[model samples]
Target: MPKDSRQGSTLWSTVLADLRTRLDAGEFTERFPSDRELVAHYGVSRHTVREAVRRLDMIERRPRVGGLVRTPPTVLRRLLDTLTALGVQTSRTTTTGEHHSVEIAGRLDRAPRTLLTVHTAVLRADGGPLICLQICSAASDSVPSELADMLLDGSDRESGQVSVVYEGTVPAAPDPEVCEALGIPTGSVTFCIEARLDLADGAPILQRAYVRPDRYPCILQFSAP
Candidate 1:
């Protein structure tokens, strides 16, 4: 039996091969050319360039609409700090609470069957909803009522020193609630990030966060290894 030669080739396949050759020859060092430049050079559509670059893992930073891209809470304890560093100010639009009465096992060393309080807020920048934050915590956590309310209106001083670790990220099609909040189309693809925040003692203070990445483009920085 012989392998089919067509199986490994595509219209964009040659583009990737050319890029790989250029990379080996030290053509790209710090950044890749813009999508427009690549399309003109490769004679392919912008979509082809995006998909090829994505498959080759040659691009990291996403195109931001504003001056700087929002760095997701991968490092900063305060998500507000992350956004501020990106040069954007956020205002909370709505806050809602969903309390699960049924006993549930807690994450990050909390007691089993602990009550969970889920607080969700839609944050805006420049008068448009930027992202939706769904934060969950153990109901026993000593969160001040005022502080909880502050999360709905603006940033607070107490929401720092918490270590945030991303648990997972997935692509999802927009639902009605998300579409309305982010003002995106009903079926647009959105990036959803789930993370856990823990106290200094390693106990979980905040269980999780759900972030909508449609409006908030992520800042991806890489260095030579």
Candidate 2:
């Protein structure tokens, strides 16, 4: 395909076919130029750029759009940390890979209690394979429900950040039931996930999640400040 491809075909069928050929022929691999770059190089408009890479084409990957537009690792880390922003949903699935449950843990009025916890199977949006098993625990007496049950059916009304405050909380070890539920070894390092606990409490409360970092990662996105 010529850089300034003004073939003027209204129906991008031919153009798309050509673009796909270019892509398959190693024309747009490892990097996809921006609309401006494409225009400067190919004499196409921003509209053509959108038409080429619109959502309908299933081209959602960032590198497909911003080939060399690399983000600082720190910024990417911080963005990944915020689960909602990344479209990371919590749900459960049977061993047969059937969709089972979807729920959220809540908190109650200001009270120091291990309120809500959950065990969920994480899946990528493309739904190709199971990503990981996410076992989350909240210590705030905010949401009063079994963590597992919450995974089945629960509501999350508050928008807050889950953080880690202190280490070596009382009991100091993973709860036996939680360990069983999450299938983690008894001596595994359980992450102390301290969330904002934004419910009835004005200040942050202790929401501890005993996680196996090996299976699950603490995802956060960070960019150059």
Candidate 3:
């Protein structure tokens, strides 16, 4: 092969590899770049850009319907269930500690002056950090044995509890502590889930979790009426 042609081939292969990495990292979730945009961004010829994207099965190109569209990443129907469906093995580390936060106490329906036991857990999948959870409940002695056990192991054992979950996204930059725990760099985005579990005959348990969507995308399914 000619020297310039060989260099072009190598460059396109490099672009293809980077594109795959960005796709897996959820960078193109909202939009897939145009051939012109990719050419400009990667400083390659339009033919080179097309050659790189042509091999990506996740991108669909249809005539007149739309330009290149990215297929959504596979979603985990529920994270609380065993991660076997996603072929991921998960492990967790829990630390028992005390927290005195008015906000947490209010959520748990405890007195502002009461001391709370916080169970901080960092869940990993296949040795990679997945999520970090902080569960707050009444102090050690007052907490039910079952609830405490569940908290310690990071299990979802709300047999007779009313659970309300609030989810949103937050930038990881401001939360250096959480970024370190989740093994994600600062300036990355994370999904945050806050759950209030109200037991039948006990104070509510407040759980806050930060999840890395790029690593583990999750979706909730609802049936039509």
Candidate 4:
């Protein structure tokens, strides 16, 4: 009689392949099995089970017009709303201060000598850091105070009235300040979303957001039309 002989790395690969097939078949619909359950079901060591599960975490299947397509990191307009919808408890830390800047003034279409109010926020999910956001606007009466208040409190005010000039993700190596804010290591490769939002009145709001994709993976799905 021949004995079943798969072991070690070979066994881990076999288990991973089987898990992928099961995932495609929607076997684990409600929830994924635990390590103990997987080990018992596959008759493999816990180490092998862990190795397979770790790789599975990196796999994201996105549907497209033709077929499944790879997804790139992208910006989420309503960050707090999305997280809450996903049943993740979120919290925010915001700081507002005045800064004298020429570049920010130029972006907001104000005079170069204008003062700016900088609003910085760190959004956390389940007590873990997720996004570091900064907004710059003119520190004058012309700019509506409610806009600043809404941003500071993570309200959706003026969301429908704003137009996005540019919104996308870029590979970034965050500076020491951003690294500390997002709780990521210095020199870590991450995604930064730079967006220029314009109000109906032509007032510009410059927003820069640093996102930790590993902690908060940005997955976008599209259906074929």
| Winning candidate number (lDDT) | 4
- Model 1, 1-225: lDDT tens digits are 112233334645767777778876867565667777777786667666666666664345446311111223342234556677788866775454645533333443556666666665676776787666555666667543343334433343234444445455556664577667777777767666555656445545443323556456676344554
**Among all windows of ten consecutive residues in candidate 2, which has the lowest summed lDDT?**
94-103
Q: Considering TM-score, which of the candidate structures 2 and 4 is the better prediction for this target? A: 4
Q: Count clashing residue pairs per candidate.
A: 0, 26, 0, 0
lDDT to native, each model = 0.55, 0.40, 0.65, 0.68
lDDT value, residue 16 of candidate 2: 60
Lowest lDDT 10-residue stretch of candidate 4 = 65-74
Could you tell which candidate, 2 or 3, scores higher by TM-score? 3
Model 4 regions lying over 4 Å from their true place: 1-74, 78-82, 141-161, 219-225
Query: Candidate 1, residue 20: CA error in Å?
Result: 30
**How are the candidates ranked when ordered by lDDT, highest leading?**
4, 3, 1, 2
Q: In candidate 3, what are the lDDT values of residues 39-89, reduced to their tens digit?
A: 678877878877888888768765433255433221221464547656778
Write down the TM-score of every candidate: 0.44, 0.29, 0.51, 0.53
- Positional deviation of residue 133's Cα in model 4 after best superposition, in angstroms: 1.2
Could you give me the TM-score of model 2 versus the true structure?
Answer: 0.29
Find the 10 residues in a row with the least total lDDT in model 3.
Answer: 69-78
lDDT at 145, model 4: 41
C-alpha RMSD in Å of predicted model 3 compared with the true structure: 14.9
